[model samples]
Target: MKKAIGQILSGNMLSKALGLLREILMAKFFGTGDINGAYRIAQTGTLVPINFMTSDSLNSAFIPLYKKYLAEDEQRAAVFKYCMFLFFSVVSILIFSILYFQSEYWVKLMAPGISESAREMSVSLLKVMAVCCPFYLCSGLVNYISMAHGDYKPMSMRASAQNVGMVLGVVAAFYSGNYLYLAWGFTGSYVFFSFWVVFRAFKGEILNFPIRLETKEVKLVMSNFWITLRPLLILPLILQGNITLERALASLISIDVVSALDYARFITDTVVFILSVPIAFAGLSEWASQTPEQVREKIIKIYYWLALLVINMSFFIFLSARDIVIFLFMRGEFNEQSVMATTHIIQGMSIGLWAQVVGYIFIKALSAHLNNRKVLVVMVFSLLSNAIVNVLTYKIWGAFGLGIGNAIYGIVMFLVSAWYLKIARSLYPVIIQISAGIVIYFCVYRFIGGYFNESTSAMLRLLVNGMVFFLFAFLWAMLFPFYRQGVIKVMTRKRLR
Candidate 1:
């Protein structure tokens, strides 16, 4: 189990490093604007179905069954191959039909605040993106096969390829100075990424596209798929509420508000991806292989370490919000107005980073336990609350309101997930540790902020204050015996050693 966890962590770290580089390049080139927003929306449309069908549902169902079949009979490899072929065929057809018929409606609905020119651009981008859906579906099949075969490195590299492709595409777009050509680059990347995965899976001998799909294998796959989808079917409604609210409220704002929100979110997501990926890759795969008792113990330890990590990260971002905006953005055409707009949004989002981290872990734990129904229920409530807040706030405060509403929603979700996890195991100690760390960090930051004169550079002050806060936090955690032990446990893991 430890070895498996190590493998996953190593792979995820590599993938995340490349992904971060891609984001830095994106920030440098595009900054925050209408073009980036259109790209995000178009990508979101392509991703939504792929997430539901493949990464989300297929992994939960296909993995255990594939392992079971392999353990029981070597000949069952044929069954697995046929099953993947059938799954891909059915999903590809469905995805193609939806994208073909509803691309215009979705584009208009998602960004109704944009101008006619932007809207047309968005629709065209969506059309190009639609072609990548089948590729993603196929890629998902290959990922499942690779994982089942215990060849996660290939799978990781395949995942990383998308980011590499995106980085190249963005450079191409920048050189050409054409948004339409940039959109094509984006589409081309996905197509290339899919082929890369397919090629790797073939090389690994983990995937074999059968000449014909067998009816028995089809039935077997369908049985597992239905079992998976039964719990996941409610996810779309429960999860998309916040996004739906964002689109609706952005439409009510000026033309650029949606684009602004999307760009700000891109920055927030970068932070999330960095912190969450390592914990998730290490924790989930480890927890999955543990016995109930061992799993419970591991969860408690991980929760403490994760809380500490998130607290530190949240403070760092919150204190350095302005500097980060200026440093990453504030380039050509990403003027003062854009910086101010994005800084406001990033500040609002910083408040929720802690909650987002906790919620991610809780959700992954639930999925591991096959308690998807419970998770679905929580997501539904969170989505509903997010919608109400987004609508009310947008009416009152415009674009900034959307950011505030999302922050509040994130807090609510974190509390709810914490409550659920607590019911499963006592979380009061973890909560106390996190609260203590935050209070101490903030106190130190305030002291440092007071001493800094008005004449000092904002970026310089931010850097100095952030270092002080982190130093204080580290000392504070070291002073607490329990937290010190937890830190040692995480840092001294065999993988790290």
Candidate 2:
């Protein structure tokens, strides 16, 4: 399990780096312009449905069932594999056709705040990018099949190929000044990746192309998949609706607002998603069928560490939001206005970043438990909180308010998870350490090395400021008896060795 986590973390780090690079290039080339806004809208429209299905309980149900069949009988596994492949292909094509035909209306509905030219451009881009659905879903199917075979490598690069695609798109748009290539490059990614994974799947013998699709196992597996999946159906709608609501509200303010919101969101989610994915994967077994009481202590430990990660990272990032934004994105087409806008959004997001992590983990655990009704109730309350806050605050704060709305949504979900899991009582011991860490970190950075904010090199300032806070925090922690003894024991062992 540790080895699996390490492998996943390594792949996630690479994919995240590539994903970050993709966003940086996009920001450099496009900034918060009309075309960038259009691209952002087009991406939102294209991906919401993809995530609705791909990231839903269907995929969650896929691998375990496949593993079950493979363990019991390889032929049965193959038959079920072909059956799912066929089913997903039909659904993908149907989705693509619908999006392709209705691109204009979708674009208009997605972002009414943008100009006519931008909207028209996005309609074109949406039509082109809609072709990605079939390839994307099929690629995921192959990737899941490979995963069930104990091959984690393919899933690691799941979105890496898409990031590479968008990187190419940014470069093409930069050189040719034709935004259409951006859409084509986006679509082209799924095309290339789908074929690549299919090849890998065949090579790995996880999937066989020339196979009998009809078998007795196919019917049984299909029925079981539905049975396993039926109750979780409302999940995708609520999750997708949260994203759609935020973007739509951002657009109501201005297209620039939505673009900044999108870019800033990518920055926050990169780290959050990377850390949380592993926790979710780890907790899957505990959640599968166990009662909450059975896993309370174990989960509390995990949650405590996650809390530490969230608090420390959030304070550091929130205070240093400007420097990070400048270092990463304040280049090329991304100028002063864009930086200011994006920094504000990042700061607001950092405030509740931990809530997103907690909420994400809670969602995964809940899904594994197969309680979709509870999931729906939790998610819908979150959505309502997000909508009310967004409508109330967006006009006043613009993109920052939208970011706050995101934070509220996350907080609602986390609150519900706390109630359902009933782990708040167990968290009391760590609360002091967490609070002390927050205070020390803020004072050390804000009063001392935070002066480095005026330094010319953004990177240097960030490093120095971060070191100053963490160093002080470590020393402060050593003053505590428990932490001091832990350090002393480690030193004593080192000397003995």
lDDT of 2 by residue, 1-497 (tens): 45545656777788788888988998888888889988989988998888777864665677656666777877778788888888888888888987899889888777877889988888988988998999989988887777566666677786677888888888998899899989988899889989988888778776764355555657787888787776667767877777787778877887777778877888888877688876675455335546766556566757766776676777778888889989998898888888888888888888778877877777667666665566667777887888888889888998788878878887888778666767766655565686687886676555764564364699988887788766766676676675678679889999999
| Cα lDDT for residue 29, candidate 1 | 76
Report every candidate's CA lDDT: 0.67, 0.77
Candidate 1 regions with alpha-carbon error over 4 angstroms: 1-31, 55-57, 73-81, 208-217, 281-286, 408-425, 440-444, 447-459, 486-497
Q: Return the TM-score for each candidate structure.
A: 0.86, 0.90
Q: Clashes in each model (backbone N, CA, C under 3 Å)?
A: 0, 0
Query: Which residue ranges in model 2 land beyond 4 Å of their true spot?
Result: 69-77, 208-219, 282-295, 369-373, 440-450, 453-455, 476-497
lDDT by residue (tens digit), candidate 1, 30-87: 7656676677667766666667666543465566556667677645665666666766
In TM-score terms, candidate 1 sits at: 0.86
| Cα distance off (Å), candidate 2, residue 104 | 0.5
